[model samples]
Target: MSTTRRLRPGVPVASAPPPGARPVQPGLDELGTPLQDVTFVVVDLETTGGRAGEDAITEIGAVKVRGGEVLGEFQTLVDPGGPVPPYIQVLTGITTSMLVGAPTIAEVLPSFLEFARDSVLVAHNAPFDVGFLRAAAARLERPWPGFQVVDTVRLARRVVPRDEAPNHKLGTLAALFGAQVTPNHRALSDARATVDVLHALLGRLAPWGITHLEDLASATDPVPGDVRRRRTLADGLPDAPGVYLFRGPGDEVLYVGVSTTSLRRRVRSYFTSAEKRGRMTEMVRIAERVDPVVCATPLEARVRELRLIAEHAPRYNRRSRAPERMPWVRLTDEPFPRLSVVRDVRAGTAHIGPFASRAVAQQAVDALHATFPVRQCTGRLPVVPAPGASACVLAEVGRCGAPCVGGQDAAAYRPVADAVRSAMSGDPQDVVRTHAARIRTLVVQERFEEAAGVRDRLTAYVRGAARAQRHATAARCRELVAARRTDDGGWELVLVRHGRLAGTAVVDRATDPRPAVASLRAGGEHVPAPVAPATAAHPEETDLLLAWLEQPGVRLVELDGEWSSPVRSAQAVRDAAAAVAVALVAPPAPLVDDTPPASAPERRHTA
Candidate 1:
């Protein structure tokens, strides 16, 4: 049997503010109620089964505390109107006979609700106990007070290191925190044990500045003391859009990032609990100082951040560190042109990718070969076939034109070469039409797996070609100016030269933007002409610019060169490929199951 400490008569509990009256607001330093001033009702429940509505709660226990002082306790057994399952009987030591004369839930609900009024509820896996109580209230047609609940199990996972406690089970945490009372099967003993665990967790969180009630609610994985101390490093940073660099002791750049909001707040967050990434935490510890490069617009800041990450190849930054490593599919500059994946761009050659990987680029090549009779052999083929030269197995299977063995001379293969060149540069309808027909044929033959493979290859080719053509058109222009209206009714102007962001400026809504545009043009970076198939800036940087330019409400202020894709461009192919993909992955019809599902079995503990 667990003991109950009844509430003293005439003691008033706190209530909500009167209707329509404004509540008093706390100061910044007192943003939330201090943890010590909060009243907590630690609770546990013993139930006949795991479910709430379907089963019933057999016993209820709770302890009320404030400022570490025990104010009261509540414990009771209720008649569940049914027999307790034998497993639950063994688990909770509450037999069917023991609940025979106990008060029904209808009789016990009012007293328990009054005991827990105006307090934050605490529990190990709170949903299990609180859910049962709410279900009971629903059954009685009583309006259950919406109490703020906290789960100590969730709090322990954040506060206690896994090394100190192997798991966050109630029994495990109770023992780890040295609780005064050991939890048995009974309700009150577990509630008493949970109170001690809750206090110990609060103590551990104090050093991390989680001293307030709202802080406890929002607290995440603990930020180290050293990391917290370094928050001061962000003090002098300006509150504006910009790029930031974290520098190590040797002044080597460790990481580069951009912020569209306040640089100071963003940098400070790196040292706070919100930055939960392990690699970022390690980077912060190694970082010695932060350097800010404030920009006039968020786009400029993003572009500059990409450039810096590419230049420094920062060890701590995972993305855009090696933009130069991206592979492109180039039509080799030879008498017999063939697709080749190359890293560096040359002055003159048709190219079709900045593919995500070599494997994807190769797939695109396969799609082209399946459609065109371009040679698949790697070695350079002579203008004329040698006397004893032999054609490989590809020629035997009609997959290649076999120009190496005079099956088709360069003159005869000119139309095939021209078709492949057209597909790579201007018109891709031939490849798209060929692939669609083959896919349909495969599907008719019920070769779904083969059809899917062809679909993926076609998708890779079309998407990569479309992206490449879009990039090339923009990169070919000498200078382009564009503008978009900002949220504050100002204009954000940008000067781009050969796909590189040369300059950016923000103009006030009241002021004329012509002078600012002229000034930006005069002061912009001097970018030289880019070699064919290569953008003046990194492909990633150009990609960012293209995306920005394509956004709604953007106006083209000026242009120096024609920027256009072909009439039957790869964009159309891309759309067709998307349709094929949808048809390929469509789910099959669902099967009907006529038999009823069995009820879930009761468990020993909700935890």
Candidate 2:
């Protein structure tokens, strides 16, 4: 069960001139705030989304204080010129309906800045909230005004030290300060509560001979954990799904994750990640914060996770955060076309697919090439050492157009070569080229018998390529919903049901999603606690499998080593498997005796 209600302001706001009224402003300490008073303006903003820079703000809340007593307060919901994302609205309780008539940041910031004059800026997670303010301020060409900033989150960990407080979330600290927060998160309400917690925390800090303002300013994060405090993150956070960020001392980002479980537990697993034993654990003395965004559903979490991983590029999330270069199977538009690596727009490539892996691209290529062997060779192909090798065996076998031996010219060979390139680039009409050329050659030579054979072969090839491409494409989609297990006790075997030749790995389970691989680096099992079962397939593995199965048409990103590549055709794989099973099951044959039937073994009759 949950409840929602408006919180009566704890401190009344100072009277101001009317709406859109302006006031005097001053600034000093780094983050665009003055250094004079012990005052702090704790801020929180509700916007179109959690992506601070890309998403615009719909609401802003700033609490003004001096000498640890509230002096003024500001709150406003701004019209962002767009509807708020459903997920953001759910988190902040500030929907588009609520912000339709509200003023925008430009209209509100001028007044807020005047009210914030000569005060230290504050926020629970200063980097994120302030980041939005700075970006918005930048659009107006206003310098952040270099205000000295202080984080109450940093203070609580230093003064209230305990293992139970490892996470130090706003909600937990709010309760600790005798300030209660209702369920639905609203901008002004949360900002006010953060201000209250800072005051409460400052009161406690006084006893540790830490009363001086300068002493607090010099403090940084990655503070030592009060491990003995013993707090559980799952029990602390709502079950809502969202993205999480791990910050070490001084607010250096360590990792990021998406979760449908307790934010605390999801983050806690990172403390025990298989990679942690390698490089991640080196962060033991550094992490001072765990920031999270609780969304309404798992779908939002997934979307946010992908976005954050790309934007932040956290150190520990390499597999999720690495840059994605959509792979494509390139077929050059040359006289004797050849396969080549390419990205972006180019006039020459006849075919290319935007895949995540080369293997998938290769899979598409392999299937298409057999059907459309139109390109025998190309100009760009690396020249072998033979300067006068004359046509190699490929030209002899009819696989090459003999361009090296001067048998063909780029202009004359352009069309068929272009067809081959297009076929490998994921075109479905690949097998048609074979029949077209055979028909034309037959018409010129009057060779009806060979033309008929070519037609039949072309038909079979097209049908086969289409069928294989259909399956490969479906497998790619299945990867989106495929099951995954990261905490396996042994080599994470990804079963390739399609059984391909050059059997490429379809799953990579480590911090980097690559082809299916064996990591001697991860020493034992990384089995998760029994509370949650294994699910959600690794993208790296699925991407790799897709590349191999769809090769010549699609491809996958490379793996760490020689992966468990595919076995090509499914029928051939099944036959081989059956043979192995039979060999294992068959019993030893009986021994035969070479003796005349009438004279042999008469002693047995006595029995």
Candidate 3:
């Protein structure tokens, strides 16, 4: 496709510098240009060697552009006096026999340099190629051109990333982009790919307010592409605990996550980390940049995350509508009183067992007895153990009826396990439905709060019903066992294929609220919840947290089938992430303040 029409009106592109003129800094003139109009040239070179300082150039090709419009093109082949190395000749299909009487760098250098005048230099592996040109300039006693250069390799990693591929070699990129590498290894062929890659890169950078040539040319080393540009912003982040934002280009918000230590490192890892493979690649694609807001402590990061989430309402953030009204689990203080789902697990009268993974906590009631059994372990049966007249382990101690051991009927233990499951799931509706028939027995003789708790639990279930609507409807929600977190958590879902999602389930639930939500909502197979608080300093915990947090950089999150099982859950995440990435690719909508008119100040929270 012609990129000129898609130039975003006047967006700057990485174009080759004019020939026979010294390279100059790009973008400065764009700033000086009318409303940021400037020329750009996507440049490419093919040579007989590797080292820019020592290699001999075989071909040079470039595309000159102004304000997103192609003005002209330049290409030429130079002869190297010495015979080309065997490997070099094989790789590039160039031969000393073909270059019998070609012009030397001394002759072609002037035209190429002059043509590049007042424009930016661009190459697939820009540094390697630009390095050679710079060295050549120095060898000729001319100062190396001060022209700005754009690295399409860097741009490809940011614009269109893939975890399977390490460095974005021209061939690797061409295969994925499907852009024909007709004249592979030839400067003109590679130059065409450079131009195409530049166009894709420009589209990716549009969201970052990176339009003018000078803006792209003057960028620091690596010419921060879409996702990698986050590195620069990450530098300002402190290692201490803090919240971070993954911003799309043009200052659009992508994702909001928090960390306890090494905020900058964590953020940097998301862009460069390797473990982030399998989902999250889409964010890397749209993420032309990132901007971080640091905090001195983790507590601060939590508060900050909540506040930012409230403000940004990042499409990728958790989808709870009313966090303050979300349900919580309530376990009575009595030795083994029934556990109830409530609105405040932290507020009052509730011994808040830390929120755990959906699977761990759901199946945890039994696991807990396995760890510490007691007179407090049973629901209907009394806590005393009986003699060996066929008693189970818990029954051996009078704790359980030992249905599995044949002490009691399966029917007898069913209700008990069901209650445990209900409690773990925080399903107040189940509690009410199961025990409502007993209401008449405790009728006027009861503590109202206990009964009221049941009513409130039912209400929470009802309220959450509407919220149970699926986000990834296209994700096979019917067969999917999704996590129903109350509130406060984030998930990393990778979308690998153009229309499909792939990869592992990276559920990061911490002592923090958002993570708590993520833990509950991630329901595929069973990944055991963290044993202690996520604050525990274990290497596995740290590594897992880091893997989920930044995704080890964008390229790594391709949602590939590297991690298997939990297919439904993985699809759920990938579907959600793809939905968000799609939104990011388009323009962002204006933020409308949801607050009510000042005359009705109290209604602000009603939404």
Q: Write the per-residue lDDT of candidate 3 for residues 307-354, one digit (tens) a residue.
A: 577667786665332343433334443323444434443322322222
TM-score each candidate.
0.60, 0.37, 0.35
Off by over 4 Å in 3: 1-36, 163-167, 175-183, 217-607
Of the candidates numbered 1 and 3, which has the greater TM-score value? 1
Which ten-residue region of model 3 has the weakest summed lDDT?
469-478
- A best-first ranking of the candidates according to their lDDT comes to 1, 2, 3
Instruction: Write model 2 residue lDDT over 91-188, tens digit each, in one string.
Output: 45455677877888889878777777777789887877888888889887887778877876766666565544545788888876677553136677
Task: Compare candidates 1 and 2 on TM-score and give the better one.
Answer: 1
> Model 1: which residue pairs collide?
none
Q: What's the lDDT for all of these models? A: 0.81, 0.51, 0.48
Q: lDDT winner among the candidates?
A: 1
Per-residue error for 109 in candidate 1, Å, reads 29
Cα deviation at 252, candidate 3, in Å, is 30
